[model samples]
Target: MKNSEEFDDSFMDNEKVVLQSIAEDLRTCLPVEAMLPSESLAVEKAQQNCKPTVHVDAFLYDEEAVDLLCEEGKMSRDYCLLCGSHRTAPLGFISHSFSALELRFLFQNVLPDLSGKMLVDVGSRLGAVLYGGCLYSSAAQLVGVEISAEFAKLQRMVMEKYDFTDRIQVIHADICTQTSLLQNADVVVMNNVFEYFLESSEQMRAWHCISQNVRKKGALLVTVPSVQEALAALQGKNGVINIHEWLEELPLDYDVYLGKDTDPESFKQIHLYRVL
Candidate 1:
């Protein structure tokens, strides 16, 4: 028991150091918003297509990071209701990636040993999961499929800088076209993948494609906001057939504490599933 505790403590420290380094490198490379031109345009169009809202990509800025930004006068938590008035409305923030903290919780607590397994991250903006997987799990391969060339290039730069090429691969292609990769993956991770990047119609197509291809029995699927929630929004409009036929939701323990600053609610947004 003592040995295991010691190992866990040491590992956590190492993990924090590595993730912090990655975050710093990313901050230096990207702008404060961390939205590439293509991503910003897509978000604009998607917002126009659906409900318009502010989305802060979680990979680049977690709640704590946002707090730091606010402290530094780089970001704000609320906007003024009147230009000169003190009255303000809190900004509704939406995150587009599995945050760094969430990734730690996911790999350390949620997933089983991934040695010799392949994990694919759909719409891996900034390769958060891939880097987390490389550091936190023993997954033999981590693949990220991104439609944006610019995002893909940025991720590749990080991977190369950190020497993650042996296990990490970024494919610059739409996930709707990567059925074969999905078929072979032992684990598939979607962090608002289609919903954030694709139009409602496109998201529908992407989900259907995922459902049909990610059919390897016993394969795991990790998603933010649960797959059910995602499918429900597209039920009548997008023809997202029931996912229950293909997958089963796995309950997660939410009480595990990673830090004093970690938000339990954020962790709850993560859900796990298995191919049935």
Candidate 2:
């Protein structure tokens, strides 16, 4: 990343405008809901197993997008019970991918400069992080491992549409099979990958596979909700992976502001670790 202080305010503003434009263009390429038929399993799992309240995917629709949906009368921030009675509560939303602001925060704030680094996004749905990295960092390679063939096809299409083929590559395969690539990665990002999508047993398997391979000394591992929080549920099935010995948790400065589209709580969920 270049020194933000060196650039004039207008230049920084223009940079953000460019990224926002890309996000808008990407939105036009997909369905309004942004949940494709290819993601039926994930959508079903989210509906049945996620929290008791309404669950909204945060990847495709950020806070700003949600507000627009509310304006169109298609979605609501709060649902009224008893046929539009006054009693209502805010909706619970969840997402598997980073928003554009979050991605900007990631590339500009959390992670170090990636002038010649190779970063991999596990379960890289919609290639949001890849595009953000392409815009914010000078990473040599931004690889995405996605299990769904259709989603992978979508990612490739976007890459081709925006001429990002040189920097980003989408591989339609489960992340467990990419041991060598993980080993070679300078940075690996996992955004609440398996909790909702996989059963307890499958989560254990994927976590085990990740622990064994992404162990290059000093490699960075970024996870939403922290590694300990994510892996705690897998306790009984996951005696093989010990995070304290394998990775060291690093504190992040969530005090920094990314943009108006991002909230403070959103920044707190992101946790960074260093491979030991």
- Which is the leading candidate under TM-score? 1
Q: What is the C-alpha lDDT profile of model 2 across 110-196, one tens digit per residue?
A: 999999999999988778888888888999999999987877887898788778999999999989899999999999999978886
Q: Provide the global lDDT of candidate 1 against the true structure.
A: 0.84
Off by over 4 Å in 1: 1-12, 45-53, 238-240
Question: What is the Cα-based TM-score of model 2?
Answer: 0.88
Window of ten residues with lowest summed lDDT in model 1: 1-10
Each model's TM-score, in the order given?
Answer: 0.89, 0.88
- What is the C-alpha local distance difference test score of candidate 2? 0.81
Against the unseen true structure, what C-alpha lDDT does each candidate score?
0.84, 0.81
Which residue pairs come into collision in candidate 1? none
lDDT of 1 by residue, 1-276 (tens): 433545555555676677778878888877787777767655675466433356676777767788998999988888787899998877767777677788989998888999999999998888889999999999999999988887898889989988999999999998988999999999999987776666788788888899989999999999987898988878887565777799999989988867654677888999999999
